[model samples]
Target: MNSRLPENELDELPREIIDFAKHIAALPDEFQDDMETAYNRVVDSVRRRRRILGLVQEALAQLRLDIKYLMFDLEMTRRERDELREQLGD
Candidate 1:
């Protein structure tokens, strides 16, 4: 049987996964069923893990930006408080 994956699906998959799938496909017909099932499970797990990792990376970036904004606001507030104290003393 032809073992090549579709072009669109190949793009996101890592080389190792592709190679593993090709190896599985090379197995004898008697083992194809079990091997293909296991391969599908592995691919699904990898995709899920990748998606979670991407979400975490995105959240981390947003958190960093939020921290920068908060720092700026805190500095401004402190400066305003100092100015108010000086004016009162005068």
Candidate 2:
């Protein structure tokens, strides 16, 4: 499969599963390769996918934290602006 997803690759299916399918497509012919090696590759791919997912989850959590802080800061700034405006009689 291509390094990047093509338009057609987008679907209800998760990207990891789609990537796994792409990996499967590139796998060596079953009868031509050692079974153990093939199995190991498949296992490794699954492990990699899990790691990627964990990282994505961690990033999302951090983003949520950042957004929460930003919202609080925005409210505080708006309140300060209103106070300043009242003091200035504007």
The best candidate by lDDT is 1
- Relative to the unseen true structure, what is the C-alpha lDDT of residue 25 in candidate 1, on a scale of 0 to 100? 79
lDDT for residue 57 in candidate 1, whole number 0-100:
100
Worst 10-residue lDDT window, candidate 1: 1-10
Tell me the RMSD of model 2 versus the true structure. 8.9
How accurate locally, in lDDT, is each candidate? Answer: 0.85, 0.68
Candidate 1, which segments miss by more than 4 Å at Cα?
1-4
Model 1 TM-score (2 dp) = 0.90
lDDT of 1 at 64: 100
Tell me each candidate's RMSD, in Å, in order: 1.7, 8.9
Model 2 alpha-carbon drift over 4 Å, by segment = 1-33
Q: Candidate 2 residues 1-90, lDDT tens each?
A: 324445553463456666665665576777334644564465566667878999999999999999999999999999999999999995
Model 1: per-residue lDDT, tens digit, 51-82? 99999999999999999999999999999999
Q: Weakest 10 consecutive residues, lDDT, candidate 2?
A: 1-10
